[model samples]
Target: MRFGVAFLGAAMMAGSGIAHAALPAGFTVTIEDAGVKSASGAYFGGDINNYGVETFDSLSTGVHSTYASTFGGSPISGTYSNLNVHKADQYGGAGGNNNYAVAGISQTGSYAIDFTTENGESLTYFGYWLSALDPGNVLEFYKKDGSGGFNLLGTFNPTDVIAKVGNNASGTNPYYGNPDGTFVGQNKDEPYAFVNFFNETTGFDRIVFKQTVASAGYESDNHTVGWWKSQGGNEVPGVPEPATWAMLIAGFGMIGGAMRSRKRISVSLA
Candidate 1:
């Protein structure tokens, strides 16, 4: 696909430090162009233990401090601060369709979601559709430290993805057009992408979205979470655990050899 080269260079330079500083030793980030559709298709497989998507459709329009919902049959409760749910058309970079999305508001230009599953399992994967990317928008992942504090695991933004994969060249006129057709021709100057964060070791449980500039907001939709599987053959460092290997073998046996042919990209942090 085609990308804006000039913008890509600038984004790379600006986001370089954030990527290095925020990503922990064992975490990786993957970015994919959704291309006129949602990225929901990428969230499945034997590798994922449990997964869910929060569409924000059921929530009322306003600031919510606590929200609970089930995604993909898994129960998830989230605590938020200064997070507001707005109808799609209410925001400039948002997708259309009478649907809804969440954004950070007020003086902070930031908001966060601290997630806890009903079973209290650690989350290994987090992803979302980032629309109308801006330099001010920043996303951070964190894990709970032993002493009731949190440790930052990674920091990312749409610009980082553009620096890697470039920008969407095809699709509607605006590269970042809403696949749902709600807000066509809007945010033409901005780029959009589906970003996935995976932790190879211990996983994270909290996500924070912020806008560094005053009055700007962080807008996103289809927040997804899952338990991810590592990739490797019989090798040592990257190999999956025995239990996971067993699950993969069993899954491949049932699904047939065709599933093994599907292509996937895995990025490891340096």
Candidate 2:
């Protein structure tokens, strides 16, 4: 995939001192007992036990998305290329709600969430739920490379992203067997499996989710509305951390002391 070399260089120069380590290869998927929750504005760092992990449920407005990217206080902001949102109903006699979750566009193409307005933050890890109603549906993740473009991170199976819904009893709709992994409820869980990458501290300003159409006319509805956690960048650190600031101040103090000592010695020697 292509990268934004110039932008990355500038970013590192500007904030490497405060930057965290790169996210490692592969991501983690946790099954939460609570149902998918929606969050807005800046993402607050979650509980300490989760190590600052914060989960957000992203839902589409059921309308065409544009550059502005706001669904009335939803944490989602991105463009939908030539597609509209779809809600679940009995499509082709399937009674499951997978076909009607947020971001459930069937056309299978690339969709993005823009966080550039939030000062272009970074994230170490990110995962979202996808509903591949049919077997052939596929999804992929990408992050901005910084040059106004995208870089592919990983490809996901609809099977891999199915939500674990026992935590929410209302979602109990029986689902067919998935070749990937079995779900807790016979009913399909709004898939929340996350693909972990080795880079643990690399913050991503934007996330791109792409869908692959199963067949010529048949489309798998995409659902990003379930809970998914991120490692960092819920709130962009516009300034250095306290420790970094302390180090800077101490460095300046040492430099001043050394200059003073050198001047005194020269005077004495003279």
Candidate 3:
């Protein structure tokens, strides 16, 4: 059930223009940019052994330097310098109901979530809806070493994923006209995406979301985590359906044709 190169190759060939950071062998990443929170929930929350999503609805509005909660069956604690909870309508393309989202304010803005379980179980899957991506935003993953220290696994950002998945930040993006339509036509330049990280060989227990630049803010909602498992007791990662693959292939075909035509014109002009 580990989706390795064969699945990735099909996704690429089908034109599902998603890109990912270089991960350890047997790790993979998937991204969804065109849909709303429910879509991402279904994608990541289904057909798993355990799954949960943190919508930030119950938290009081304001800054939270330290927060603790349980997601799925995993106990999680978060520490941040300036994590602010704001009404979802305040930000364009922010996921969740009309509730709230956690934001890392500009300048020294960052948050870290540590999964603490006495059993020392690792999580093989993670996901979040990242809204209004800026160049300064970064997402880092870490694994706990046996000695209470954390080993950095990988670092990623929205721009890198968007470069592979094509920008869908326009008004046509479904999230722009979400329920209540409060965020319509706002923050059109910044893309919002649901990013999925999966590891088949080794799992991680720590994740960090930060904004490196002083000018930008990191806003996101619907933090999700899960352990991949099928009803048959086999480990299986969530993958795109056949219809999704067909759609991606058609989209990629068009893009490829356009690029080829542009290349021909450039050669002729040269």
Candidate 4:
């Protein structure tokens, strides 16, 4: 084969392998501020194939939405049904109806959540969550290492968000705090909360969100986990799902069969 054709084939093969997913390493998960009616349209994780976000509005009020989606309603393929969706927002109101965010629960105190991808994913550093209250409430992040040890990434009081982030309210960088916080702002008071963090360099299988210890459960608005995606200029390519592998194999097989049949016809003509 000519060098040009060989190079084109290799490029084409590489293009076929690109898939939808966050990069496992050196990826940044950014969480922006949310309010009753947030005008700012943004995402914490990577781009979605549908709906852009995995909002559990399909769930009931004050109930955990059990699904294998990243956040919205997209389904995770195959037996890799580890991605679960949980939402605590009970004040369910449509966008611009009552100026309410599909998320943002009035539940008081603290709430927690834990997620573990099948093979475990490499994370940049840590993650953050949103809530309705902040004063006296706390949110903590932890990652389970390969040795089966749970390491505390960091503890954040929404009240301290403004002080820490100061002005960075909406950047890809981890420290770009949430200024539109509805929870206890840096442990300040109600209607003023923000539980967000940033990356450092760590590989964690499981991520745990420990709500600030209190009498009641806190309203968990969101959890931001930043992973890089190959389609989005990922440093490393992602592995294809089982179904994708089958399709690729079938496509190549058909091409091979067609080529062999064409050669047979050519010999008969000659």
Q: What lDDT tens digits, residue by residue, belong to model 4 across residues 79-194?
A: 11212223222212222122121221223222233444433454433333343332223444456755867666544433233332222212232322223424212211122222
lDDT of 3: 0.52
User: Which prediction has more favorable lDDT, 2 or 3?
Assistant: 3
* Candidate 4: worst-modelled 10 consecutive residues by lDDT: 261-270
Model 1 poorest ten-residue lDDT run: 255-264
Global lDDT of model 2: 0.31
What TM-score should be assigned to candidate 3?
Answer: 0.65
Best by lDDT: 1
- State the displacement of the C-alpha of residue 83, model 1, in Å, after optimal TM-score superposition: 1.4
Q: Please, what is the whole-model Cα lDDT of each candidate in the order they appear?
A: 0.55, 0.31, 0.52, 0.31
- Give a tens-digit lDDT track for model 2, residues 169-238: 2333232222122222322322222222223444444554433322211123322221224432122113
The stretch of ten residues in a row with the least summed lDDT in candidate 2 is 261-270
* Models, CA RMSD each: 14.3, 24.0, 13.2, 26.4
Order of all candidates by lDDT, from best down to worst? 1, 3, 2, 4
Clashes of each: 0, 31, 1, 30
Predicted candidate 1, C-alpha RMSD: 14.3
The residue-by-residue lDDT of candidate 3 on 73-126, one tens digit each, is 444433333445666653423443444443344323677888755456887777
By descending TM-score, how would the candidates be arranged? 1, 3, 2, 4
Clashing pairs in 1: none
